[model samples]
Target: MKPSIPYLLAYAFTLASRRADEELREHGLTVRQFGLLMQLRLEPELTMAELARQLGISRQSLHEMVGELEQAGHLRREPGATGRTLRLTLVPGTARLLFDAHGPLMRAEEDFLRGMGKREIETLRVLLQRVLAHATDDEAWLA
Candidate 1:
């Protein structure tokens, strides 16, 4: 029997995330933590809510991740410009981790799509974005 679309995508994502997670763990980071670092790197000084929104995760979950990261000395916490908001400062440790993991991460992604042709992957990206757009549109209408 053929698996449903969501089931197949979930399976693929789980396997890919596990691979990336293993690579990142060697550097003392989880995939979610790496996502936080990526967010900070891309949009400096994002508040916890903003970070959660950007990552499509809960603020409470992000808060827990931040606590863990700060404890690990990978990040420094600072007060945001606005009232009671929290900001994350990337420590040198995180920068080093991200830099060192670059090759492995890239190779992991390459290995993931090795089974699929480039054109196929590109088409998949377009289709996925269309699906996401419709979902977000429905959400906006509901709001």
Candidate 2:
């Protein structure tokens, strides 16, 4: 029997996450933590709401994650320019760790996508983008 698209997507997500977890393990980061760090690196000083939107996670969960990262010296939160929100900033040392780990993570993804050529990869990207566009939280694609 042929697999449904949702099943295929779930399987792919699991495989990708597993590969990412393994690659990030040496750096002492879980896949979710690595994703959070990357988001912070990409959007410095982002408000908690904006960051939560980008991550497709709850603001409360993000708050907890921020606290953990703060304790680990990976990032910090401070009052936002508007004063109504808190903003996150990635620490320089932690930024370096993220930068260093990026190469290995990309390599891990490439290894997982091994038989795919450039065109195929691009096609897959486009298809995934389409799927993400229809997600309940449409903004998740930004992360």
Candidate 3:
């Protein structure tokens, strides 16, 4: 029997995430950490407060992750509106890791989109995006 769209999507995302995790683990990062780093890379002046809000994580958790990255030389704290703020350090080595990881990450996405044609994938993407948009605004949509 065929699973529902939600179930299938969940399973496929999980499968892809697992492989992505493996690749990230090789660089000592989790998905969340990578996202954090990416955000900081793009907006190198974001305060820790802004980052926490953007990432939807508590300040304490963001602080912890920032601490780890700082220890690993992946990021640095710099002057903000106030005393200091967190921004990712764009070291060449880390940039190289990001470049190295992109291929495998995209390959996983391509592999997921294989069976479905381009139009079908676009339709599914739009539908899922709408669902998520509605879900974020309404408790009933979630229930």
Identify the candidate with maximal lDDT.
2
Q: Tell me, what's the RMSD of every candidate?
A: 4.6, 3.0, 5.8
Better of 1 and 3 by lDDT: 1
Stretches off by above 4 angstroms in model 1 are 1-5, 125-143
The global Cα lDDT (0 to 1) of model 3 is 0.72
Positional deviation of residue 80's Cα in model 1 after best superposition, in angstroms: 1.0
Stronger candidate by TM-score (1 vs 3): 1
> Which ten residues in a row are the worst by lDDT in model 2?
134-143
Give a tens-digit lDDT track for model 3, residues 44-78: 77677777876668999999998887788877766
RMSD (Cα, Å) of model 2: 3.0
Candidate 3 lDDT at 95 equals 68
**Candidate 2: what lDDT?**
0.81
lDDT of each: 0.78, 0.81, 0.72
Clash pairs of candidate 2?
A: none
Candidate 2 lDDT over 1-143, as tens digits, reads 99999899889889998998899888877677888998777668667877787777898898888888888888877778888877788877997888778877887789889999999998898778767777745655644
Model 1 worst lDDT window (10 residues): 134-143
lDDT of 2 at 132: 71
Predicted candidate 1 versus true structure: per-residue lDDT over 1-143, tens digit per residue: 98899899889879988888887777888777887887687678678777787677888898889899889898888878875776789987677777787777777777878898889988876776676557555332222
Model 1, residue 45: what's the lDDT?
Answer: 69
